[model samples]
Target: MNLFTDFESRIKDILETLESVREKRSELDFGRVNVEPPRDPSHGDVATNAAMVLAKPLGMNPRALAELIVEKLKQDPEVTDVSVAGPGFINVRLSVSYWQKLLSGMARAGVDYGRSAVGGGRKVNVEYVSANPTGPMHVGHCRGAVVGDALANLLAFSGYEVTKEYYINDAGSQIDVLARSAFLRYRQALGEEIGEIPPGLYPGDYLVPVGEALADEFGTSLRLMPEDKWMPLVKDRTIDAMMAMIREDLAALNVNHDVFFSERTLHANGAAAIRTAINDLTFKGHVYKGTLPPPKGQLPEDWEDREQTLFRSTEVGDDIDRPLIKSDGSYTYFAADVAYFKDKFDRGFDEMIYVLGADHGGYVKRLEALARAVSGGSSKLTVLLCQLVKLFRDGEPVKMSKRSGDFVTLRDVVDEVGRDPVRFMMIYRKNSEPLDFDFAKVTEQSKDNPVFYVQYAHARCRSVFRQAADAFPDLNLESVDLASAVLGQITDPTELQLVAKLAEYPRVIEAAALAQEPHRIAFYLYDLAAAFHAHWNKGKENPELRFVNDKNRELSTARLGLVHAVASVLKSGLSITGTSAPEEMR
Candidate 1:
């Protein structure tokens, strides 16, 4: 259950009662309110901006509204005290019994404790890692893959019906390069010399297999055919091989998409989604043929004034209206993307998310505007920008260049550091910020690595359980029957603090999900780990304060209950971000 949501429902009831008594019909835009723990623990258990958010809209003084809400909260027995602090921010102090109930709820629901129905099972399409399906996915694609997959996981847990998708750029000049490159490999497989790949062609050794397969299939027949005749067969087979390679790379990081849409298929075989998108936009007055202006700073020598088909995205929110068709009468990359989003809206998904490289930042506003136009402002599309990744080994930079095709692949990183560390480190920084992935430090068993520290917290908790088995032979770590045996036996300040942190789990999940900031989860896990470590260290300082006191079975059970809750949150969070929580850290 979502404790914060339950509290919000109750607050709404009280507010409705007040409105009735006062004879008012005004709505309080409470949807924009936020509830979270204060940065300073001394302030209180939770802070809310209800008063500040509603004061101006409701035509009331901020301090006055805060005081009214404080009085309303104070009447509830669950909330022991409520105070207004710092210009109408409300701080709430709940009874320890409220925290105890949280642990009971966690134990009852297990891994499902933090899930909320905020999304109401609405469909959301997430398109990401739509890298050119021409070669192996390099390190540049890894960050977007992690962010998109983790976001899909988070949105699903928050009650969304999420569909992960990849858009293959198969119909483009790049694929023509792939076709010609494969033809060269096909000749090479036939013992011909195609020395030092031409500068305009793909040079990766991966095309060798495609060439060999072609020789096996045609047995010298294709060699006699015209270039155009062989282009289709070579292109399709090359795309198939490239996509298979990309899927395997994604599989290495445990990322899987629900669907794969091809760009070339958009206007091929008498079924063109792109043409349909343009027609729909044209019918809606969002598209037109217009002359474009020359560049303000520098006009190219080959520049000629011409008319072009454009989308009026600037009126909606784009900085400049965008061209959908190039001068050569071919669809621009933006046109394919518009069709992709329109397809998502057509598939009954009202929500769409695009995880794009940071270099594509300029496209965010236009893409969202297009989605708005196509779906008549009903589709809410969000674009997450994944910044560059800087790779370092022993504090030295590891250079990467994909065009040269000698860069590090996703598999290389995962194979070197394993999945948990790679996933955690990739998400430790906000997706819009560049990440410094130091190879030397990630694998080191030190507190500097946040992944290992969080895992160590979980592993230490398990060690305590193992030791408990030695002290209390009858105690079952997994026993729900022990609930009665553990109630109200916990007393240490450190233990109580840890329980309160666990009580904040549902709130943390709700906030993090709404913020679309998975880095917050990483930070929260670190704080939770700190709390668990603080209490564990206290046990070493005071042997009588230890989890296993031979004289008191009640205290042992209570402390174990707290330990179980800590482990539960760590496991839940790690699972959310596709990280693993090991029972032992060896």
Candidate 2:
């Protein structure tokens, strides 16, 4: 159950009662009301702004309205205390029974306890880690991949029908470069002593296998073919091999996408789809011939003002008109993006989200304009810009890669520190903020490492349950027994504090899902883990507070049930982040 949601409803019920009692006063709308935990826990368990918001409109003094609301709320059986504070805010302390009941409900629901239906099964397409099909994924692509995967998992848990997608950048100048790069390797494979790789071509040895495969398939025949003929063949084979390598890297991090949409497909079979998308925009009067201003900053010496087929992106929300077709009559990258957006809309996705790097910040407005223009405002597109991740080892910056030569590959980090640490650390901060991932800190088995701390809390919860089973051999201690625990025995304040934190899990899931932020879950888990760990330490000082009580089996069962709830939530949260919740810390 969402405890805050329930309390909000109760508060609204009290307001409605007030409206009926004071008919002479103006009717006040409660739609904008809010119920959240107080900034100061000592003030109350939950705080509501209903009285403050409704007071002026209802022609009553704010304090007077708060008093009236408090009077009505005090009658609620679950509301043990109610007071008006700080001008008009209503502070409410729910009965201990309220939290106890929530704990029992959590045990009963287990990992499914925090699942919500706020999304209403809407179809959402989340595209991320759409790295070019030219080489292996680098560390730059790591954070976005984890963020998108975890956000997708979060949306699904919140009842959205989600499709994880990657837009394969296979139809760009970069692929031509990849083809030429592989061709050099292919020539070397066929006993030709190819000298130093050209400056623009990829020089990574990872493409050696692709070159070897091409040689095995076509022998020296490809060498004799014209550049146009062999380029296509080599590009296709090289792209496929590179995508395979990229998939392996993603798999190593436990990140996978449901759709790998190819940019080539947008212009496949004679560019029909690209033409169709541009025509649709033209018909809507959003396409026309125009010349863009020489780009800001460095004006190209060869820059010339000439007419080109342009999308009037400014008609929607873009800062300026965008080019759709180049002077050579080839569709531009933006044109292909328009077609990609159209394809996603036609696929029935009500919402489309692009997870991009911080460098793509300027692309957000144009993409948003395209979505609004293509869907005619029916579908929404949102872009999340994930900032860079700085790698560290023993407080020193870590850089360089064996795969790409210039930077670290995602596989390198995963291979060094296990997948769980990589996944958790990637999302331990907000996407827009830069993150520092330290090898030493993440691997440490201490509270300083959030990944280990949260996992340790889960492991500790399971450990206590095992201890309980051994201490009280007669107790069932099964799923049935735990759910049916006598929670009334949980009277300790520290024990209740942990229960209070658990009660907030449902609200946290709902809010995080609504905001499309997975980092919130990571932070919430760390806080919850800290609370559990603090309570556990308290037991070391007070023997009676220890969860496993040999003589007091009833209290032990209640404590075991609380521990079960904590473990269940930790597992659920970790699963969303694509991390594991170990049964044992070691």
Candidate 3:
């Protein structure tokens, strides 16, 4: 169980027993009162500001209220000591028995120890890596893909029903260009030279197979048809081919989506979905026919000076009103976005998250406004803009991949450095911060390589169990009942510190899921690995602190339980990050 959550409930119960607190119970906001690990571990096990937040509401001096809370807290059998520090902060030291029991619970839970129901089974839609189906996915899309996939995994682990989604931009003008590019390759496949790839069309050799497929299917018939007839067929075929390539690239990195929502579906049949969404917004008084003033900076390509259908986005949360339709009566790109979000809302999603690149920062406020307008302020919308990732090799900037024509394909990076390093290093830093992924650094089997280090910790944990098995052949390591194990023998300060780190796993999962930041998981795993490694090193210097004690079989078994707990946590966390926790480091 979550110790902080357990104490938070217990502390609130204690506050409710107070006559002063009961008098203002209706006005008191107990939500502000929370328990967390103390800033200084020496102070106590858990710290809370219960008295500080409840003091004024209860109409008592802060310290006086603290003393009252402390008195009630001391009555808890699990609490060994309670103290008030610096105004009204309460610190409670849990008994050693409590920690030992907690460790037993952790061991029994195994890899599922940190799984929580904090999300309450809410349906969350995470849309990421919706790259245009014109070419292979580049490294520019890698960060958001990993971040979004990990976030979805984190939310699911935290008990949320999450749907991982990808929006295919197949209905845009870019698709027409892609069709033309493929048609050129189709001609080349049919024996025409087709010398230079035009400047405007995609030049990647990746599309050559699509051309050959088209030629094999339709042969010279496509060339004889009118532009309108052939263009539609060509677009469909090329989009499918490109999406297939994209899927392979994503799979190589272990990223997959539950739904591949097509933009073409929204634009089909006279743009029915778009028109229906506009009418819904219009009925809500969120749509109007108005011209927009030229934006201060570079005017967007879709921005029109003439009167047009507009979304009154400013009425919700956007900085300026957004255009929904062009002067030619055709719907703008934002119109499709409005329809897409309405579709997600109609799907019964409680929350929608869009993981876009940093360049799309401008879309954040407008998307938030769209959610408010479309969902009528019921559904929550979040846009996480992942900053760019720069690739380097041994301190030198890595060059672009020639296979992708201009940029490094996600598959190229994954194939070169392995998927674990790519996935782990991509999220090693905050999504909002720039990440420098160095090829040489991540592959190194050193402490500096976080993925390797964390994996090594798990491998080391397994190694300890192997040593225990060899040292004591009679010991049943597999069926060692951790609940009845001699856990009290694990009294070393460093060993207890490792247990504390494991205790933070559930808290980390809940916090990261709530914040929609999976980088926190990566950061926490690295810290946990460092703690395990540090403890392992200490054992190297002091034989008595080692996990396997040949002369002390009971103590060795207890320590093995601790090692199993560490491995379980490491394996669980790595699974969430889409990385593997190896049993033995190669």
Candidate 4:
């Protein structure tokens, strides 16, 4: 159904035809040939680099090949004009009937028009928002959460078997700190005067509920137990409470994970999986015991050379060998990461995508090295490092949350600006690029706000349907049967331009999904919305361009069909980004 793909296929067929006419050129590879929209819309609707790609291989000059291809392409009934530009790029102008027919096909497809099967149903594991289960999710976790969720949605829409996962950092010392913090709150709950929260403990009042629940559950029983006995129980309870709070916060943002994988599971019960994975690495000669030089930069005063279990990460492209076990005979964080990746590999995931904070940029090489070592060079692991987001109010820096100490909680952002703004703004920029989210701008009703602008376009389309129904009450506008829509009547220049933008949607979805970049969807929707709004504004200058033409029901129905297609594409794109496309805006 994608016209661009259809054109590309046609171009390939022409190339095949040319190759058959000259069997000597059959050895040339057409794999790199590409068909896309020309840079300048004035040039053409669709463009191809078939001649440029085949020139050197066919032992023919680009312009000569392009002329031959253009001659063959002009014969196409759908291609109204064809020309060679620059070196060998072929620019094609399709007829209005072709665009009209494409619109008709789109109207029939409805919201499923842009769905693609490029992924071929391969399993992809997307892990993000793996914030430690020590407290509620904060603003730091917001970008990755939205990005990861949208990516999973996009992948699923593109035919990938996606697993949205959260890795719980519950096996770390942070969990112990959380336990001690909760214990203090529990003592206070029991009427003990626990004054001035300790320096190393979490002082957030969110833990008070966990403390009160613990006090009610065991009362004096836990208080009588030794530190070792009580600490485990306290840690488990605190992690559960914190994870519950995190999940609730995610729900507020309208995000959900298919699986919440625990890092502790790798090392629990005497490190079974960790040992097994390490043994597998050992069998592959990736593990070794080594003593090394001190860190390159300013060495620590207490730095000492010691033997430790190390992975030969450098052999697989890591900057340096990474430690697996520390001097205290405990597994390093990297060891747990390896086990986690191994678990995912065992689960039959063909691709593993980690949406991590930009601060973890240094960790990428080693993680990729681990993936290569663990999967025997078959695992495709991609890490998307999301840069920081700075919140602004009226152009001033927003202050931190007093409730959560130094950082702003994710719920705080969602509560203030609402979910749609939060989700949209999060991915409005590239993951590796920093974003500035302005509350004042996001909340504004004007078209300057992207989410509002896009939603308003959808609302306007719905508004058109309402206007059409009232203008022609007996038209039966609710029917999905757009076959009666006389698309040939949709010949207005501005209207054709809007439809042209709509035609780029499937290409946008396929490209964004293939690149694993969801921000492209956001940008495309903005452009589509802008084009739609421009067309809507055109009607104001000329009343004859109005969507509801009581004097001309044939053209009116055709225009409404176009509006319906726009709305459907908007809703489909919004759904993939986890944002709602409102039919009405209050």
Q: Which prediction has the highest lDDT against the true structure?
A: 3
The digit string of per-residue lDDT tens for model 3 on 1-586 reads 8888999999988888889888889999999998999999999888999989888877789999999989988888989999999999999998777888888889889999999999999999999999999999999899999999999999999999999999999988899999999999999999999998999999988889999999999999999999999999999899999999999999999999999999999988999999999999999999999899999988899998899999999999889999999999988999999999999999999999999999999999999999999998999999999999898999999998888888988988999999999999889988999999999999998988999999999999999989988999998876789656845877777888888888889999999998888999999999999999999999999999999989999888888888888999999999999999898977
Per-residue CA lDDT of model 2 for 1-586, tens digit only, reads: 8888888898777776775435743455667789999999999899999878887777778899899888888888988899999889989998888888888899899999999999999999999999998888888799999999999999999999999999999997899999999999999999988888879989888988999999999999999999999999999899999999999999999998999998988878898899999999999889988788988898633334788898999989999888888766877888899988999999999999999999999899999999999999999999999999999999999968867867888998999999999999999999999999899999999889999999999999999978987897776765446766746777788888898898888899999999999999999999999999999999999999999889887888888889999999999999999999999967
TM for every model, in the order presented, reads 0.92, 0.97, 0.98, 0.97
lDDT score at residue 325, model 2, on the 0-100 scale: 85
After superposition, which runs of candidate 4 have C-alpha atoms over 4 Å from their true positions? 19-22, 298-304, 483-486
Task: Give me candidate 1's TM-score against the actual structure.
Answer: 0.92
Decreasing lDDT order of the candidates: 3, 2, 4, 1
Error of 1 at 315 (Å): 2.8
After aligning candidate 2 to the native by TM-score, how far in Å is the CA of 555 from where it should be?
1.2
Worst 10 residues of 3 by lDDT: 482-491
Better of 1 and 2 by TM-score: 2
**What digit string (tens of lDDT, one per residue) describes model 4 on residues 1-586?**
8988899899888877785336755577666888899999999999999889888867789999999889999899989999999988899998989888999988888899989999999999999999998887888799999999999999999999999999999887788899999999999898899999989999888888998999999997888899999999998888899999999999999899999998878878899999898888999999999876787898533233788888999999998888887766777778888899999999999999999999998789999999999999887999999999998999999998877877889999999999999998888998989999999999999878999999999999999999988888898876645644846787887888888899999999999999999999999999999999988888998999999888998889998889989999999999988999998998
Q: What is the lDDT of residue 152 in candidate 1?
A: 82
Stretch of 10 with least lDDT, candidate 4: 299-308
RMSD values, in order shown: 2.9, 1.8, 1.4, 1.7
> After TM-score superposition, what is the CA distance of residue 19 in candidate 1 from its true location, in Å?
7.9
